[model samples]
Target: VRTVKPELVFEIGFEGINKSSRHKSGIALRFPRILRWRHDKKKEEADTLENLKLLLDPSNLSPDK
Candidate 1:
C-alpha cells in the first residue's frame, strides 16, 4: 500500500458510523467507499470531527426523524 500526504479530499459514502475504541479517532465507519473526489471543494472544507459525531446521535439515526 502506498501512503501519501493528506492533500486531497473525497466525498465518501458509508452504510453506517459508530464510536469505536479500536480506532484511534474513536469512530468507525461501516462499508465506507469513495463516492467521488471532491474537486470542487478544498481540503480545508472537509467535514470536521464534530460534524461526523453528530451522526452518532440517537435522534439522527431514527427513520422518522
Candidate 2:
C-alpha cells in the first residue's frame, strides 16, 4: 500500500523550549502546532533546521525581560 503525505506547511512562534526528548535525534519542537499552511509554497521551500535554530537563538529572544 502507498502512503500519502501531508502537503500543508505552517509557521509557528512559541515562548520557549519546555522539554527535550532523547527520541528522534534528541530534537523536538516545544509546544508546536499548526500555525498556518503555506499552500503557495512547495515542501522544498519550507523552513529548515537552520531556520528553526536561528529563530530559537538566545540572542534573538525579545528584550522585554
Candidate 3:
C-alpha cells in the first residue's frame, strides 16, 4: 500500500493505504486491501500501532513507545 499524506486524505477522505518504503530488500505485497473507507477518521484517527505492525517485520516494527 502507498502511504498518503493527511492533506489529501481529508479531501478524498481516509480511503488510502500503501507502502512507500524504498527498502528494496523487504518483501513486497502483491495486493493490499483497504480495510475501510474510514470517512469517520482523522489522519491520526486512521490506522494504529497494531495496524502498521501487520506489514512490518518484528525487528523493524515499533518495538518501543
Model 1 segments more than 4 A misplaced:
1-4, 59-65
User: What C-alpha lDDT do the candidate models reach, one value each?
Assistant: 0.77, 0.55, 0.43
Query: Over the stretch 1-65, how does candidate 1's per-residue lDDT look in tens digits?
Result: 34556789989999988777666665678899999998999878898878998789564453323
Candidate 3 per-residue lDDT, tens place, 1-65, comes to 46555542232223323343543323333444445455666676654445543655555443221
Using lDDT as the yardstick, the better of models 1 and 2 is 1
Assess candidate 1 and give its lDDT.
0.77
lDDT of 2 by residue, 1-65 (tens): 34446466677656564223443422346566766767788878877655655545565344222
* Clash pairs, model 3 backbone: 1-18, 1-19, 2-18, 2-19, 3-18
Ranking by lDDT: 1, 2, 3
Query: What does the lDDT come to for candidate 3?
Result: 0.43
The clash numbers for all candidates, in the given order, read 0, 0, 5
RMSD of 2: 7.3
Off by over 4 Å in 3: 1-3, 8-27, 48-51, 54-65
Better of 2 and 3 by lDDT: 2
Worst 10 residues of 3 by lDDT: 8-17
lDDT of 2 at 64: 28
Q: Which one is best on lDDT?
A: 1
